[model samples]
Target chain A: MLSTQENAIIIEDLKKSFKNLEVLKGVDLTVRRGNILALLGPNGAGKTTIIRILSTLLHPDNGNVFVNGFDIKTQPQEVRRSIGLTGQFADVDEYLTGLENLLMMGKLYHLSRSVITRRTEELLKKFDLTEAARRPVKTYSGGMRRKLDLAASLIAYPPIVFLDEPTSSLDPRSRLNVWETIKKLLNDGVTVLLTTQHLEEADFLADTIAVINDGRIIAEDTPGRLKSRVGKERLELVIKRQDDFERAVTVITGNDLSHNSAEKTVSLAIENGVNEIQGVLNQLAESGIEVDTLTLRKPTLDDVFMHFTGLKPDEGRNEAA
Target chain B: MNSQLVYKKAYWMAGDVWVLIVRSIKHIYKNYDQLLGLTIQPIMFMLLFRYVFGGAIVVDTGTYVNFLMAGILVQGLAFGSLTTSFSIATDLQRGIIDRLKTLPIASWAVMMGHVTGDLVRNGLQAFILISMGILVGFQPTASALEWIVIAVLIVLFTLAISWIAAIMGLLAKTIESVSWLGFLVIFPLSFASSAFVPTETMPAPLRVFAENQPFTHVIEAIRALTLNRPVGNHLWMALVWCFGIILVSIPIAGYLFRRHGGR
Candidate 1:
């Protein structure tokens, strides 16, 4: 529905199949430069397949991928040059000291010995990892390895970087630390293409969010816009009397009641405004349905994802997004 | 920071594989105890076969250690080179390769790094084996220039065998499976060539097969240098054998490496 020429990453009609399984079926993605494009998807939704193609690790059976205005198939090395990828599990060599991992990446990027050395120190300071720089990576905590992984990717500071669930396994505080680093990168004008299943992550970091389900994008919008699609906030109530509940449903359903179930004891969905609650109580009081409970809140992104995908992701894929 | 910097940085990464080489070395250094077997196992084989079995078999009327050690050195390289291939397989199984696969430098650099690293490793094993043989009274008969010829011959043979091992590593479905599969190559080559004794001591038909084998010529070429004997037609034959393995194994390994990962 939209097109951008100067985009950092553009994927069109991308289809990839393995043997009999069609992992990605006609997917399209366009990531604006310098913005964090959050690719949110449930497990097995072909998120990694998409990332691999964009990063030039895999090729699509059909369609074209353009990274920094270069075709991935024809100019893969150039595409690779324009992007850095940090995978689901940070595959830093565990035997190497954390400092050595970053330095090694800097060297692999072909910075001069002096340049790689400089970048190594800079990244260590930036990631707040200098304190543990000499420790073997295996000794570092999950969060530290992730931080080191991020620091290593920035050795060359490619314009676009792909982070595959860089924070999925992190504890809240460490996750927050990673978020701060990502924010710093954004401030530095680095474009991040992040694939994550955490709705909160997308909410906290995304400039745009695309919800993928069953190998296709089901929805794409700003986080707030996606949440708003779940409809107006409401007070849900379960009462004692069935007749009174029926009456309450009739009364509340008369207004802005979004698809509720009255079959259960006294359930009434009403817009979550005080006026609406007061209006429902007056109607319920007249019908003699003694109210048991009532609560009101705005819908969460979980609700939005649940609504669109028809089911919430019951099992999170432990691997990075 | 800018497009100019990105390509420039990636261009530079390819030239700095030494850091990765160092990392590989450090990994080995850390696990020094575990690799003691890699360094010493071949030495034990040399001592045992050179002493116990040495006098039993004769190839060209020389110290059997000198003759058989040539073949043993060839066999040792063939054995040691598989470690490189298996290490690649292990890296893949451990998801290490997956991380490197996404890096910005030349994608093929990972394979190159592994191959170079393996050559270093194979070179070490060859040196240790050669040094031990030198200590056991094995002397070089060839002059310095001829010695260089034999060293070049050994390097080529090792490279070819390493490529085949690399192919096996890439195609095997599981790391454990590949590790076990690689051992199969070692046995036949070691037993069928002049590595343990000499091709002459074998039963007639077995001797014919042994003499016809590429490894037989490789060992013969090494034997000629060690004893300062005339390098029979086997010298040319050894070079041809090494080139043949390289021609066949490289494309096969390259195809499989790309098939498994170059996607």
Candidate 2:
């Protein structure tokens, strides 16, 4: 019984802990209807834990959650009925054909036999698994299996779908394919909450990205705003000679310049990339410092994450990978 | 209104169980090798016991083969029920349990569906083992009505054991642990009972343990029914054992199943 004014999902100071480890530390979030909210975080930042709590698979130790306007603690069935969940792993039965997997999901949704049949056919076609419909999932490639997994979640046309790291292990092409499927869901007005460690994924797919670290949402905003919050585009100059580093730094001084001795590069945060780069090049040339390479780098989601968390993305990515 | 909702929920749960049962049965059909593995073990034990160990064991019956048929059926079922464990463990390991948990259906339906599927499989194994027994000169002296009773009792016993297996499946940390746990239980229970030899032949303490175990009662009841012996308290004892297992296991299994959060 969600009112029109209510958000698709709302959380208030949600807390969950396992034994001595507190995974989610009093987190709050709101996902509006028909929007894609990406929960971007490093491993063990409690991204999956939050998704699990929202999907009613795990209960929060304390605090309140409403999914489609139903309290998750007291009205779990109502919450479950309103949401579809595609877990981090592809959860389809390997022995069953792609068609049977979808049909089984449809049956669990309490759809009629005819409706299940029709929906199974439509989903198979939609996910581009029509050719592989009769094949057992064990024989499918990783991308096809993921597609079928997502299709299984949509069998009942739930108002909201939770994709937990849907493209975590997918190759570039397969990730794009899943992104296409997600866009289709958005086109149909189905709200989506996806968790990912990939900044590029959040940048491309999320309407609003929540950057989480150490069990807290450190920053939340649109991807553009998040990147801008870090700083504007950066101007990078790789000096041809190591001795020219000091001169390059002097030219880019008063512009928040950072020098990397190992890479022999000088990077500066700039308000205007073109004008700043022009002035720096003129200054460097007048000072007889030959630049090996110069490029204007736009701010990416990676920069946004590093700026908010104060930790390099690679530090977390290495452990997660 | 609350009662009405409860009834509706029950109705939907039953339907969910049926759907899951169908899915499991389809899996068995597709992977016929597992089913083949199930049927072959009992037949091999029958052959080995009939040929290798038949001459050494002394039985009061006309032929040891007749006495061994019931024993083989009980042993076969005890081992066959492990398939339930492996299947459940695989589901949990592969994240299917989590998917089922998110669905708008009763949680117990997942376990019920698996037990029901294993029941059908155990039934088929029983049918094949009995056929092999008759072919190998094993004879049953039960009347048609008594035979029906034996079949129902065996299926009921299988259902009870499968519930215990389901619990092991949920609690097992890995798929490999499931088989080890099954071996630990099945090896002792099947060997310690009167399944392969008479309790009288065992030493004093071993006899005490073997004579009182639940498997002995079930084997004794099935042997009496098959041998046309006098109707005895073994039948009631077997029913109690089966009912006792179900009563103890259903709640524990359901609790473990609900507690499992798919790792």
Candidate 3:
């Protein structure tokens, strides 16, 4: 919050393609120093591609990227020295013990042996992997593997860290554990760029949320501001009979209405939840369409996606490469 | 100032390579099954050739095991280099290579680590085969200086093959393909060369290839050095071949490693 003017990462018109499939169609982004930026996107939305390019693991075909004031193209070594990357898949050495993995990573950074040793111990204890420090990573569970992977990335105490879907496949409990760990990273004044498909994750952790779809950032703002922009509540109604579905659609006045004809359900954005619900019920009564169930909910990232793109999160562009 | 910076860069690169080498060596120690395989395979080859084929294969040397010793040592070392390809391919597949690439360390350290670790492994395997040869009827009549030269030649040959293996690993799409790729390249070189038998008895075409190829010269050089026979031009030819392989392989491997995580 104090360092909002200083940028840890700056990406400009980044474009990349795998063969003919353009993964990033001119992505421009920035991460403020000492802030958590959640790259919110569905699968194959170029979230991972952006992370890869930023980490210097992959090249961008076009545009400029700078990390910690070092150009990604001309000053890659400097950029690498300043950033740590924890990929979507746990990239730690399976044959190495958790402690050995951290030590190896620390040595790769050319840290002194004493610093490496102390950092290794500190990280192992911090991640709650002290008991399993001596065990090979192959023996670890998925959650433990992720924690170790994150720990390995932080061994060098890099200025910036990139986590690509850190909690994608974790169980509920394990997901919470990782969230807590990420919060600790933020508290320690580390800049974080984490990509996640989970709306709640982005809402809970991000200082700034950038919703990416179809290889472009559709929206970027503070979570509260983005929520306010997507201020309309959602009304969902499951109709009693399939025959009433057609009549129900005609009864809905909102142009942003989306319906599943097979399920006999209609969902639409409403400006006023209470008044709109009463109006909808009366209209449905007049139209002789009986609703089986109805629910009103606050707008989430899914609703934000629908409001912005007029497409559901899963309906975003998926390219095969 | 520029020269000093370059020297400093080189110094750090060496340290980086050494660190990665230690990591790679630790992998070999931890993977007991791989170590067991490395041990049992060459010993089995030594025993099989010394006992089963020793009677029929008549060599112009002192004993069958002595002639076979050089072949066995060179062949074992060549085969041991196959693990370099497998390890590199495994690292690539498992994203460890990406992790290494993302670090600020010199890019060449990754390959150097694997290659140097393999050199140590080949050295250890060579020591094992030589001890086993002595335990059997084999005799090496070289002096200490000759032994040193032989060790140098062996290490050079291991480095050459290991670099080529590194190239194969970088080119391979998967760990499974790395095995096939390594076998396709190394199998023919070890078999068609003067590894197990003299090139004179081989068919005219294979004899031509066996005589001209790198591995034959390496085996011949080691054989001459160990037997205290005239090395002739074999040592020069072997050195040229190994250096040639290394010069060609390093750049190709480096390029492939850069393009690796692009996928």
- Ranking under DockQ, best-scoring first? 3, 2, 1
**Candidate 1 per-residue C-alpha lDDT over B157-263 given as tens digits, one digit per residue, 9 for 90 to 100:** 87887788888888888988886788887778777877776566689999998888888888888887778788889899999989999899878876777677546
- What's the lDDT for all of these models? 0.75, 0.85, 0.86
| Interface RMSD (Å), every candidate | 2.3, 2.2, 1.9
Q: How many pairs collide in each candidate, listed in order?
A: 4, 0, 0
Q: Give the better candidate number (1 or 3) by lDDT.
A: 3
lDDT per residue for candidate 2 within B1-263, as digits (tens), equals 69999898888888899999998888778889999988898899999999999989998878999989999999999888878899899988898888888889886787777788888888888999999999999989899999998987888789888998998998899999999999998888889989989999899999998988888888989998999997588888888889999999999998888888832
DockQ of each: 0.39, 0.50, 0.53
* Quality of candidate 3 docking, DockQ: 0.53
lDDT of 3 by residue, A1-321 (tens): 222249998888999988888889999898989999999988888988888888887778999888888888888888888888886643998888999899989988889899999999999999999999999999999889999999999999999999988887889999899899889898789999999887789988999999999899999999878776676577889999988888888778773678889888898777776887798889999988889999887777678888789898878777632
Which stretches of model 3 miss by more than 4 angstroms? Answer: A1-5, A59-64, A224-240, A253-256, A269-304, A313-315, B2-7, B228-232
Q: Using lDDT as the measure, what is the rank order of every candidate, best first?
A: 3, 2, 1
Q: How much is the lDDT of residue B162 in candidate 1?
A: 77
Estimate the lDDT of model 2.
0.85
Could you tell me how far off, in angstroms, the CA of residue B44 lies in candidate 2 after the best superposition?
A: 1.8
User: Which candidate would rank higher by DockQ, 2 or 3?
Assistant: 3
Of models 2 and 3, which has the larger lDDT? 3
> How is the predicted docking of candidate 3 categorized under the CAPRI scheme?
medium
Chain B TM-scores, listed for every candidate in order, come to: 0.88, 0.96, 0.94
